[model samples]
Target: MRHVISLLIENESGALSRVSGLFSARGYNIESLTVAPTEDLSMSRMTIVTTGSDDIIEQITKQLNKLVEVVKVVDISEAAHIERELMLVKVRATGKDREEIKRTADIFRAHIIDVTDASYVVELTGNQGKLDAFIGAIDPALILETVRSGVCGIGRGDRVLKV
Candidate 1:
């Protein structure tokens, strides 16, 4: 199953490398990873997305705890949580296609952040499904480029990951 593992780690050089190294050395695959400094400047928060069975996830969590920089680890997917990803798509937008693209973006509630004579850059934020659906709605031939920010997740009410 897919898991969203959040970690609080010391915000220092090589901290991210060590965490990623652990997964690499263990032959585990990380589908997506997002890391940034938290409110506490001394620490950073990392959200990792991966697929594995319950046993595998348990093993990954235990190994993560062993890392010196990893202050705490939690599989937020275990309980109620909220997850979002940001995607930016550049698509051909001219003639009739331009109007169609604008309509499609409005339907998805995405913003046309940038526009030119021949293309537009659409910014969207939502769950993976919603983003994927938007991509599906657009014609592949019209798509110029796409960029997505990996999943960022947090536990629901009362559940939190902290040092």
Candidate 2:
């Protein structure tokens, strides 16, 4: 099964490398990953997407917790949460294609951030499926160059996951 692991770690050099190294050492594939500094610069959040059996996932959690720089580790795949992803897609566009792309972008609520005679860069933020659908619709009309900030999630309602 797929697992979304959210790790809070000390914001220091080599910290991310160490975490990623663990997965590499075990030959586990990371489907997606995103890391950024939190309000407290001393810490950062690493969101990783991977797949494995129940026993392997349990082992992953245990090994991750053993890292001294790790503050917390959470398996959020089963949590009640709201998850989102951000994507930027640059597509080839010309006069008529530009108009069509703009119209389609409006439908997806994606903003055209840059435009040139031959191409356009669009920015979008939404759940993964919505982004995928938006990209799918735009791909046929133009050659697409894509960038995605992986998944990020927070618990639903008033609940918060404990560290």
Could you estimate the TM-score for every candidate?
Answer: 0.98, 0.92
Candidate 2: give the clashing pairs: none
- Model 1 misplacement above 4 A: none
Best model number under lDDT: 1
Model 2, range 1-163, lDDT digits (tens) per residue? Answer: 9888888999999999999999999888798889998877899988888899999899898989999999998888777777899999999998688898999999999999998889999999998899999978875658568999999877678655445
Please give the TM-score that candidate 1 achieves against the real structure: 0.98
Tell me how many residue pairs clash in candidate 1: 0
In model 2, what lDDT does residue 19 have?
Answer: 92
The total number of steric clashes, by the backbone 3 Å criterion, in model 2 comes to 0
Candidate closest to the true structure, highest TM-score = 1
What are the lDDT scores of the predictions, listed in order? 0.95, 0.87
